[model samples]
Target: MKKLLLATLLLLGIVTTASAQLPKVMLKSIDGKSVSTDTLSNNGKPFIIDFFATWCKPCNRELTAISEVYEEWQEETGVKVIAVSIDQAQNINKVKPLVDNHGWQYEVLLDPNSDFKRALGIQTIPYVIVCDGNGKIVSKHNGYTEGAEEELIEEVRKLVNK
Candidate 1:
């Protein structure tokens, strides 16, 4: 029974590790500066990476809701939010304006080529990935509803306690 339990636990560890891996890919910042997941440092802070497009309404709503409590979230958990725009070349130019207009306090990145999106196997927009201090994604939630930010808060809290 002990050996069986050990094996099951080992398998669960492997599965969790695989699911939390984030690819190291280069992307452009809202200011046109180059940024990469490899260099995404937050002083050992938990953060959320959200993939959205300018035209994605749910994405807009999610950002809006998150923005409402973002400052509080940061103060509580030292968590940060990174908004990655999956806008194609045609709509890429609008990303900065949209971000600025909303005054969202997040590090916005432009994934115009969708390379980051493709690497993650993302099928839709408004995808949220919560990562730990070491950049390991601890939780993933697809789509958004009214209270999705609360769900994200739970994940971020887990990271904080760890």
Candidate 2:
């Protein structure tokens, strides 16, 4: 009985953890290019998807943090970061300008309809999702602080090595 109970508990934990992971959803780039989440996975590289908003200060901070280390990350892990703007249609115009002004090199996508966001159950800006080469979501962060991108880089390294 004791062994059975322990096994059941372990199984439950695994199930809950798996369900908490993010799901793949389609997204459109600012240039109107469509990309399925599946394409990002199984592509022989890990991908990072950053959910952001033009007006969110934390989102800007998150981008800035990543930008500082982006080059090194590329050189080391070849990881690709895609920034998805969840700005509403009214504020969507700011997406391009914001990216240009900040000199962010990551692919920028617009989610004006919030399809991807809703699918992922994202409720706030500055959310991040990391996927392995198989396109499976490995980790995610809800917000950022100073040096948060460094932690993200570490996770990318782990995923790449796997």
Candidate 3:
């Protein structure tokens, strides 16, 4: 009986891990448009999905860093970025102002309930996922540092060219 229980638990773990590797689930854009993870993939461009919050300092730092090189990154790799805010209902209103103030050129989406974040197992802000043109999650990074966005840009270029 113990062995059977252990086997069952192992199977469940495997299933959960496999599901996490899948592409982004459906989510609503801040503008109220219905957007799906598949939509970005079908756009035939590599994209970055940044799971963040308005109050997260690291998230803001990552965005600021990315903003510095975003224009050139776009020109070089034709990659688009989508910043997904995981702020709860009360804080949702802050997303636009924050993005605008930072002058971030990336697309923004709302994940108030963190549906996408939970699906991707994102437990912290500044979590980044890179998706290929086919909507597959190619790579993911957690947290951020001074030059992390540059590494992210490099990942975007690599995926876009793949």
Candidate 4:
């Protein structure tokens, strides 16, 4: 029990510190435009930055699950979800089609070289970072499972209320 509490605190500290500053890295748009990831702000609205790839089944599942309730989530907390594709350069071409075909409504950005991933120390897809309105990371989790997005929603609620 103590170990679990300690780990939770450690995770909270990680997010609190890391969310203060957005990383300066360029991400590609579907129109072949280079966008600085740091400029991807929510204008004082908390948001979730999800690192995913075109081929990751779990990542797709998580995003799909969140998408189902995203409208309500946004209405309640004023939060947005930013989809960051860490697909390699070779597979980068698939991102736009996948997002469009799936009808995902979030801001989709491409990280062909995974520079943002490396800078954020994200070693895996389906990684989630919840950031506050000021761009301070409040919570983070790796991987996804059923009911996981519920915990994420709670995190956003906490920060939005703060």
- Tell me, by TM-score, which candidate is best: 1
Whole-model lDDT per candidate? 0.88, 0.83, 0.80, 0.87
Q: Please, what are the lDDT tens digits per residue for candidate 1 over residues 78-111? A: 9999999999989988998899899998999989
Tens-digit per-residue lDDT, 71-127, candidate 3: 898888878888999899899889998988988888888888888788777787789
TM-score of each: 0.88, 0.84, 0.81, 0.87
Model 3 TM-score, all chains together: 0.81
TM-score of model 1 (CA atoms):
0.88
lDDT of 2 by residue, 1-162 (tens): 999999999998666644454455677788888887546543579889999999999999999888988899898999988898989999988999999999999898888889888887778778998877766676768988888888898998887776
- Give candidate 4's TM-score: 0.87
Candidate 4 stretches with Cα past 4 Å from truth are 1-19
How much is the lDDT of residue 5 in candidate 1? 100
In terms of lDDT, the poorest run of 10 residues in model 2 is: 15-24
Clash tally for model 3:
0
lDDT of 2: 0.83
What are the candidates' C-alpha RMSDs?
Answer: 3.5, 3.2, 4.6, 3.5
Candidate 1 regions exceeding 4 Å error are 1-14, 17-19
After superposing all C-alphas onto the true structure, candidate 1 shows an RMSD in angstroms of 3.5
